[model samples]
Target: MTEQLPLERLAYWLEKRPDAVWLTQPVNGRWHDFTWRQVDEQARRMASALQALGCQPGERVALLAKNCAEWFIADLAIMLAGLVSVPLYPLQSAESIAYVLRHSQCKAIFLGKLDQPEAFAAGIPPEVIRIALPYPTLAAQHDWASLLAAHAPLQVGHRQTPDELLSILYTSGTTGQPKGVMLSPRAFAFAASRSVVEMQISERDQYFSYLPLSHAAERFLVQMSSLYSAGRVAFVESLETFASDLKHVRPTVFFSVPRLWTRFQQGVLEQLPQARLQRLLRIPLLGRLVAKQVRKGLGLDRARILISGAAAIPRGLLDWYQGIGLTLCEGYGMTENFAYGTFNRPGQVCFGSVGRPMPENQVRIATSGEILFRSPCLMLGYYLEPEKTSQTLVDGWLHTGDKGEIDAAGYLRITGRVKDIFKTSKGKYVAPAPIEGEIAKNLWVEQVCLMGSNLDQPLALIELSPVAREQAPARVADDLEQTRQQLNAQLQPHERISHFVLVREAWTVDNGCMTPTMKIRRNVLEARFVDELAKLDAAQPLHWQ
Candidate 1:
């Protein structure tokens, strides 16, 4: 089970757990369950249709869809047809999607639940075939059920070898144009198997998949891991129904990003004032009742393991969740290696660290402080970028490009990105991550970005959370200032923030503040605020307007 490709593993479940539910999708506000046999049959039929359309082995097909049951079916169908799958982030802009389509030479697309049809449609050439998924927003040339009805299940006589190319996952670009990461079946399988062992995932565990399936974290952690463990995957339809979906699924193993985790923490705080909640938790019998109710309300009482990744989660956020009995273990991984290098495992956990390398992986810290690992899970190389690939993979070690420090106990604490370490005008270096993490403790501050290019000291630009957004401007200013002064008191002289400035506009993916994977676009933010941030250093920490 630990050594097989995903398609082979799926075949096993189809035979053994044919009656058990494998994928659940939310259709028209109603939950629909699909058995393993149903999923397999659909995928096999899709494979036959794809082959009939003349999609050749090793050719790339793009998947432009949100997280749904059909997304898995289409993905498996691609592999079953001996073709490579190239997933496009549903939120990707027309230009970006167009670049990917051209770059990957993808001749076909599976469109499903597109939020913006015009933008997605801009990428496709007139000649490329559009295969509709169950809930497609894009006008398509073909339908999902039609394909299954028209074609019989395709039969491939042999199992896909480990060295066979499985998919080319494009990196979630937080900085530049996304690069296609080439991975073999063995690479993804190794990662999924390692994650299963580390997380102790099993057949009975339930998985909630809401994060974009195209992202490596969700693809490997929730999707591929479910395939390997034979866990049931429940999909969320949209943001409005996240709570309802979670309540319905009550997933055993939950994986999420920091942004969503922060939102959950905020939701808890809204229900019970932080001080009152703490006071209540200290009372023995009442504390137990409070904890149970709180967990139940948040739909996490059934969750045995909760993992957060994509970016460093604030330690304060972790403590807040743990206070209410949800332990969020941070995970570390990347597109190049399927994001399975390290994880803060249960019982042997360090709060701020992403834990040690998995049992099957080896991590080494280079003299430059870059975290390096040589794993079977590492991708073959970046697609069509030989020079960049050579630069990243040197002497058999994959340079993670992330600076890290390993504790004496072997826990790995990511410091920041190598490119994120910037020198101030004072000629002192500052890493914004630790400083931002500390300041993120402030309840009023939803997010913070630190910048100090050519400035004597760094300045913090803060975005208020929804609760704080509703506050009077004066109150918001005072609270932000207090938080700034308190954080400054705890920092090194050079690292201390000189001033805090309220960001006038909220940063969002559409506004270029966020990447598709929900990571802050640091470079983009810094560029947008360079002059403004520099001007703020001479002024008071807050501006009411």
Candidate 2:
């Protein structure tokens, strides 16, 4: 029978698989495991601690951390106490954190290993209780260990219904200020179960938790999926050590965003020279042997499913992975729908399409061609933003601000974000994402941002791979000219890039060009390069060299 929600599902698992491993964390070069029984016990203790601190039912408790065992403990405790969990991305700035804290009115917060706790301390008011996760060099404040040791596990009698608010996930704020997306326990449970069904996840599956749990896609897909299926979640120590950690875990199911996938693909390609690699891959026998070695080296030999979402996966990258014997499935969804709406099924995977809509979800294109969806997993509304909520959810359908077309076989191909489409001086509308996706498929190109807001045609700012920069310096101008010609040949005249600028530096989250999930903030990049693009457009053959 289907469980009502994650908390209920966890309770069921506690009864059936009390001794089974629920969470695994790597500490001091050792793997530590937590059983279902331990999870339940610790969560109860945390819930009691919150109760002891005067946290009432339905009150908000924020979690500010990376992927860790304590993160789940805090989340389950909040739910067990019938309180709402508010997740904050660990990399969020001080201002962003302060805004979320004040907006959500979170009474208590569990802080994780932060690079700058002083920033956090300054942002949050002193009256709000702060519980720091077990980390080194913590300031003299509310310690998590002391709270857990002092308080006894309260009896979990305050039960929450299926429709009760479980979580408040703030958007990444790529487009605007972050707004809290409130989700019911029922909505999260449905999304998790649907993901399990569509992805064919099982209790035996092992997931590597690396993505920020604050993001809806990772929170529901990894955290909630583990609770629903009684699977094991392995939390990596740090982002720098993810590859080494993956080698140790050998997870069966792995989910990553497009940027990580691109890096992984590049790593594989870097192992071999172009001519020799092409030749070896052509021979059937040697190609199979090389493929096995590559997969093993990447620690993906045991990977049953490699899923990419949260941003668009370049079709060429998808095809390249497929050619290398890895079935990388791309999915499409938004925070409003609990992070899943359409996914590519395992055996029926398509390259460019986001595949068929999952069970219990209806997807249709509006007259204006925006993709509209109706799903059981749909979120209730934005927290305290009734006008915006009404604008998004109307007539029982969620207006996904994505422009797309459904194929005859029911595969949804996302063309671009509705707001991202720009009209040129000739009044021809251009969807830059698709063209950028195509350009990014080239091994040399690391990142591409297309722009032409009020111009006659599109212009592109590109970041090149290190190898590409090193090897082609002498022939840089010739190579770029050839690449531009090839790209323009594949595009309509108006949509073609009239000028190209080679951005020498890499776009990164720390640099503010990319989001934490590695999505390029188009508005920021456009604003930064406005002058350079204008200069390029006026110049003859734009030469960064």
Candidate 3:
């Protein structure tokens, strides 16, 4: 069953349940439902339109959009047209966007919703054809409505073979240029099919897709998973309507990044103070009722499995969700592996660990402590970069740059990135990830990065949460000093935090401090604060920027 391509799976649904609704999209505050037949027809029409525009087989076509019904259809259309899909994050900087487009040599691009069209507009090369989706977007040579109307449904769409290249997904890295991960149809099929089975997803399962579909995690979990399982997918229209849309869908499966999960917790705490909430949870009957109310309020009432990934989440955050009767599972994967590394199964979850490896996915730790993975869904290689590819994929094993440890129970706990570990002036090395995770448990901290490098002891740079920012400076400082002292008690003498610097600005994708997927660009942050760190006195326990 895993051997079948995604398009073949789509075709199966089209034949077996043509009338079943596959996608629910919100347009202009109105919900729009598209059945399997409608999705197939639109994809076929777009496939023909791509051919009409002189796009050739085996060529690359880009899709720049948020998660929407059109984004899914355009992906299928790219596959049907015998073109490799190259998806670009809508929030990517112009330089990064230009680099990907030039590197991928995309023949055409399909534009959809973009928050900053002006910034992205500068990135597109004039030679590349632009086809705008049926939404308000940047100017394009062709529009979706006209093309679908003009072209007939492609009857003999390209049939993809198992090993045929399906997409080139660029990783949103913390440092250097983004590298394109080459994936085949078989990779997506294997990962998605296996994932659905592992999670017990079925035709009745529903997915809420708000994350950028360009990323491998969202592409696999929401789009490809739905295709393989014949499940329904609903999309959030915009940030303003996200809550209402999610409540309306009440999806069975939900996935989110760590930053958003933190924000969600912050939102909850804003309404009900953490102390009061904890007190309520201590009650028997009232605790259960409050938990149910909290789940319903967050629009996760029906979610059978809630997944958190893309970055390390604070264990305290996971426990907080558990207190509310939601098992927020953590998974570990990368773009090269189709996001199918390890998953915390529903009943057998292990906090602080990313859970055991999925069936057939071999995982081991190298002598240097880097996690090594060999899976059926692994990427072919990095696109057009044999040197990097050779370094990453060696001896049939994908060398994950992350350092991790597997317990006796087979659950994997990511320690830190091999490159991210920094040595202090005393020559003692410290893994910042675990330390950062510990600091994140503090309610005041919205984001935190621990860096010492050549210093005697590391200093923590923290971005204060909204609630923390509103509090009196003395109160915030007192709380942070307490957290820092508590954290230092658990660390080695050389690993102790020298000081805490509260940053004035929030780290965001727009400012380039964070990747589109919400992972902090550690290198960027470290460089940005070099002068600031130089001014900090080692004796001071805390400093506000």
Q: RMSD for each model, in Å, please?
A: 1.6, 1.8, 1.0
Ranked candidates, highest TM-score first: 3, 1, 2
Per-residue alpha-carbon lDDT of candidate 2 for residues 178-275, written as tens digits (9 for 90 to 100): 88998988888888887787677889999999889999889888999888877799999876687899988888988999888878877777787656
Scored against the true structure, residue 236 in model 3 reaches a CA lDDT of 96
Clashing pairs in 3: none
User: lDDT order of candidates, best first?
Assistant: 3, 1, 2
- Runs of candidate 2 with Cα error greater than 4 angstroms are 116-119, 137-140, 474-477, 537-540
Best by TM-score: 3
Question: At residue 383, what lDDT does model 3 achieve?
Answer: 93
Residue-level lDDT tens digits of model 1 in 1-545 = 54878888888887888989989998878989999999888889999999988898889999988889999999999988989999988888888888898889997999998776767777787778889997857888899989999999987723688977788989878888999999899988888887787678899999999888888888988889999998999998887788988888899999998888888877887889888999999999999899999999888999988889988888888888888888898989888988878988877779989988897788989999999988898888988999999999999889999999999999999988899888988899998888888888877878888888778888887888887877787887777788788888888898877778777688888888998888889899888877666455365656532
The TM-score between candidate 1 and the true structure equals: 0.97
Per-candidate TM-score against the hidden true structure? 0.97, 0.96, 0.99
**Candidate 2 global TM-score:** 0.96
**After superposition on all CA atoms, how large is the RMSD of candidate 1?**
1.6
Q: Give stretches of model 1 more than 4 Å off.
A: 537-539
Q: Tell me the spans in candidate 3 whose CA falls farther than 4 Å from its real position.
A: none
Worst 10 residues of 1 by lDDT: 536-545
Residues 1-545 of candidate 3 have per-residue lDDT tens digits of 44578888888988999999999999988989999999999999999999999999999999998789999999999999999999999889988989999999999999999897877888999999999998888999999999999999999989989887899999997889999999998889999888888888999999999999999999999999999888899999999999889889999999998888888888888899999999999999999999899999899999999999999998888999999999989999999999989999999999999999998899999999999999888899999999999999999999989999999999999999999999999999999999999999987888899999998899999999898988899999999999999989999999999999999999999898999999888888889998989888767789988
